[model samples]
Target: MTPLLTYLAKVVIVSGILYGYYYLALRNNRFHQWNRYYLLFCAILSLIVPLLRIPLQFAPEETSNSYTGQVLLLREQVFTPAAAAEAGRTDWAFVLYSLVALLCVARVAWGYWKILRLIRHSRLEFIRPYWLVLSDKIGAPFSFFRYIFWNSDSRFETPEYRKIFRHEMVHVQERHSNDKLFMEAVTALCWVNPFFHLMKAELALIHEFIADKKAVAGGDVAEYAQSILQMALQSRHDFQLTNNFSHHPIKRRILMLTASRRLRFSYLRRLLILPLAAIIFCSLAFVVQEQQVETRAAQTAPADTIKPPPPPAPPRPNAKPAKPVFDSGGNEVFTFVEIPPSFPGGEAELAKYLSTNIRYPKEAVDKNLSGTVFVSFIVSAKGKIDSVRTVGTKKGGGLEEEAIRVVKEMPDWRPGKQNGRQVAVMFNLPIRFTLAKPEKKGPDGVYTRPEKMPSYTGGEGELHQHLRSNIRYPKEALDKRVNGTVLVSFVVMPDGSLKDVKPAGDKVLGSGLEEEAVRIVNIMPAWEPGREKGEAIATRMVLPIRFSFQ
Candidate 1:
């Protein structure tokens, strides 16, 4: 959802920048054809730029006095469940957006339907390479593709009629209907954005300016301006897909018609769009690339360095203990130690310390930014916490800085011992900052829905690892070569323990697959309970476990 929001924001930004540039640099220019193509190209580019994934290199900033540990351990994990029949959740926002867009589409279709109805009843006359449809329903002259609709009562022999026909003819010859149709589709898709409507209007105005110029070529500009004003007083059809002769700003059209032609060199202003587009593309792609690089670096670096050092031999029980050794990076490395480090009071105390000390940033709270921040640090041989830094920031809004600050302020722990000697050990902790309070509840006593769902102790990755390690393929199902996904439903209790674990559907995956899946889930470790508001709640979840023969 965050990535989708980011992509949409980029689309808006790119479109805004391109349209702004067009208004400033090329709006009043005499090169109508060039401006028309420029606008179309920009619209296409804005849609394409957000989908590009470009790799970029940036020098990571170094924190003061922070030594790089040989192994990186922290990571941010988000759980997004696959679509399931049991969840049956309706995304109301998406439904509303789709409904509005559909309304716009139906509105545009109605306009075309009106035009087609008029064509069916009117008399169609062949006029050179165009078809002139004479209809009483059309109050004014309009061109749709190669067909031009003129009022049946109009005086075709008059000079004013000739001028109007010529203007409509220019639209048909230029195929301006294609541009109208393109913008109509854009309007249907982006009806929520006012700028898109403005863009459509601007494109239409540009079309009029170009057609008006070509209509009066080698003739008097004042006469063409007069024809446009006279036609503006008459009624016009309200179809979106057609180019009506009087559908644009009369003053702008007249001014553009009489305005001095721009110098050829002035057309060079269109080239500015190249740099504008490149800047927008880079701005959108750089932020996404930076985040990807940070996540990849955190996961891959330390694991690559810590590749299972050979296990140390057991020390003699009666002999004096040997001191631990330091790696070339000046950080202590441990493979097999006599005793691992412990927090001041064990896991419960560590939890108490985090809950009591962690403060949610006001900025983050105001913006409703919530996610887990993974902080990695070292407990030195002297039991002091040092080298505090954030390895993974799932969602940034000063959350990472707050998490790092809280971790750095933590008291010293009991350092690990290797053969009775204190040794430094790397520690990773994930601190979740949520704005939800536990007191909030829906209509139901139990929270059927929550802002944040329950997860495993470490993260979703660890949950998968636990499942893979614990789940045993049933011999009956394996021997019969039965393979299918079994949906298991369970309630994650307020205390983060599983309850009511059972298969959602009866005998759905035969051969004991469903039974085996339910058994595996019941034996799983307690999860970090899901929360609604700020309070813990029992949330029901359904997971699909697959059984297959190797």
Candidate 2:
């Protein structure tokens, strides 16, 4: 589920539990005012709880697979499972939910407009601290904000009308209309949630109970119950935002009105809500992002541990090299055997094998280098890899060593055969080492070019090596597994002294990461500063130091 969908699901679950508890424990009771507030609080809590995300982190279980192949594979873009899933498909469910929610909100607004228009059409009859809108179209007495909707044609006695007026006035004075409006909005947005509508229904009944109790504070309860029944006969569902005078199952209203069945110390039941809310906070408030150690390790190679191939042999002056013979008698290795040697499996396994075995050397990556190396080796009669040697003329810095290591550990192949007997045969595999180019930075108060660019002592490789060896992941950040790159900018001074070392770029990674990056660059030794027209001058340089656990 998308984040939005996850939130909606939580809302449904939380509201469902709260409403279920209310239905089972606190409905149609003497604590009418308390129940009304409880329902509203539940609605508010359900919506708010999902938003509080407390992230919990755990170290992933470690796993390993030993491989025997040497081709390092790197893709330019690395997508996590969530990102890939989001990229490949549309969240039509969330889209539909949003559309329906918007329509529900529109309906809420439209309901309010209808009520307002009715109030406009019917002239107000002020009866001291209460405004009444008498309209035949409105079949029942309902309160919207301040105005009370009333039928212009009267069906009740004068005394009953006064009682009804008092009942509607209770809704207005206690701001019960606000509670109705709030629940109506909630029910509209979560129209699919039966509990929200049910909660709204329970709330409306509570509102009527509250008004009935107040309207009959000193008067006769039997007459008040009779008035309720008379109004219920005429009432029907109208504007959802309005507080109807007789919105209910008439029997429950009459029963609650006459019965003295209020639970003693019923407020104690309210204590249950606290613990239930705590349970919700403990369970639904957090998200566990399971990041397995194996998966994270697979996501990125530990370049620090990878050793590159040694440089190619230099030319020897006035020297002759000796070659080893195939056997006791000198013989040449055959290129074409009756049956060619094969890997344990076919090409697909061979590719997987190579990918599994090889990891790009940190040296080459640090220097932004990439190249293809052709390797030649012999598959002997015993299916053992023998006489491995690099064939390519172009030497890829540090790449050949990793490729060589991979080939040496490969599983024994199916030996080649000549005529009807096994014989020595040669095989050549071409593997490429590639690195994605880092983003190039633009000039930031620094020279883009000079007569001679500044160079760190021991060159590019050593500078990166220094950073890798000395820089430490900040303890606070490492504990939280916050991974990112901090780009550092500094000026190499005229006297080969460093100055103005600070983090560069618009993206300032906090958590002391940028501070850590800047600190390491600051501690570095002086460099050979850039010179313009035979004069040494300070030049700005950008270095991006990436800290990652995956």
Candidate 3:
């Protein structure tokens, strides 16, 4: 069952249980009957609610795949292709309804079985005064025990036995047992319902009331009361189905039987049940319908799928001179451009290679051009790089130039593929630059740049190409059209070359692509470590990249 339907069922069950208890406690005759009717209504409604919700008609999935679309299309085309889907969904609802119905039937059957069990264990006997067969069962008072066999239990006083026999006969003649059997099945079906219990108890009380009145009509009330007392005082047998002359509130039953007052019936009281049931159903429907509307609204709300902002790029080492894109502030601007990628191994392998090779740049520290730069790059289907572009830049030492150099030198990256065909994808990178403090130690316990140099693993062509293809621009960043390089610097480990970088050159694209560029530069196939005495050494070089919208 759907969660919504399950919730509604729980509500029905709980409300029914509570209402059942309230009427039971009050014990008004009219209220008792009304409560039973109300319970019946709840059961019927619970079964029907899910059925009503089955979307018999719906909008075509081709036009739109949302709930609203389905609804609208249903109203329009009447017989859209989406009708099949709607039918399939409604079929499930029917299945659920069938299951709940089966459960209700099973529950009713169980109740009948229990009643039979109670009857089987009750004591059945024929006793005196009125010479009637009586079965004393403990569940609902005055109920006939179908499984009981009439017999005489020789343990009763003359008048006491007589009154008990008369009462039992009244029950038998009234066929109260059959009435209780029907009620039992209904109660069992709604067993989780507390109201069923109340109704059962009320029905039992009414059976006794009617019997008591009959017994006194042609007999003595005083004599009957005395006989009831005597039977209580005598040896009482606990039989599953033995009808005892006296059971529960004997004094009250005697008084009510003798009293000359007739129960007053008010038109208003009798009329209350129908309206109350209607109100309850209407309220439930309104609540559930309102919730459904809200759920449908949320599912149809528009979501923005525009690309994210470009990320910053990492600092590059000794970047070659290039046409500088700048702002009014004399600062360089690096515009993110798309590039193709080369995938020698695959996307997975490329990701691993990038993880292993990318590193921070050290020259950025010497130049003190440490900031975040956003770079954009593309990946081609054949694992090759077309171009790497930087968007933002940090000022000084051509920080943008440094970022571009690192990205341009990136190793070839594995291309991303969709359905066996190679597709150009854009990716973004952000590089951060931080100056090494004098207190910081380098390899060999000394500031040797070679031993701590950053290395690349795969072909530089592949990594560069992938970045260019996947890069995207941030709407806000593009809208501002801000152009200015924010040069960034970071150390490349092992080779101590420029790797990570952030550029403050331009805000035309968001910062994500710029950051992506930095990461790719850091992941390029390892460069031959700058050497000092043929030993691997780390060196720092600073280069700046440019950014400009095409």
TM-score of 3: 0.34
Q: Lowest summed lDDT over 10 consecutive residues: which window, candidate 3?
A: 68-77
- The estimated TM-scores of all candidates read 0.52, 0.51, 0.34
Quote model 1's TM-score. Answer: 0.52
lDDT of 2: 0.66
Residues 432-508, candidate 2, lDDT per residue (tens digit)? 56553222223453453555677778664466456545666565654444555455777777887878888765676
The best candidate in terms of TM-score: 1
Candidate 1 on 1-550: residue-level lDDT in tens?
4334566677777788888888878887788898888877767776778886554423222211111112323232221111111124565766787899999999999998998998899999997788999987788799999899988989879877787888888899999999889888887976765666777888888889888887888888888788888788977658879998987688999989888875665846877677777777777655321211011111111121111112223334663433444533476655223344566544444655565555666677678787667687777887888777776435787888877887789788767665567777665665655565323234556554466667668754455455545665565554455555565777788998998888774447687767777877798889888787787888776664544321
- Evaluate all candidate structures by whole-model CA lDDT and list the values in order: 0.66, 0.66, 0.43
Location of the lowest summed lDDT over 10 successive residues in candidate 1: 300-309
- Which segments of candidate 3 are over 4 A away from where they belong? 1-151, 154-163, 182-195, 233-244, 285-550
Scored by lDDT, model 3 comes in at: 0.43
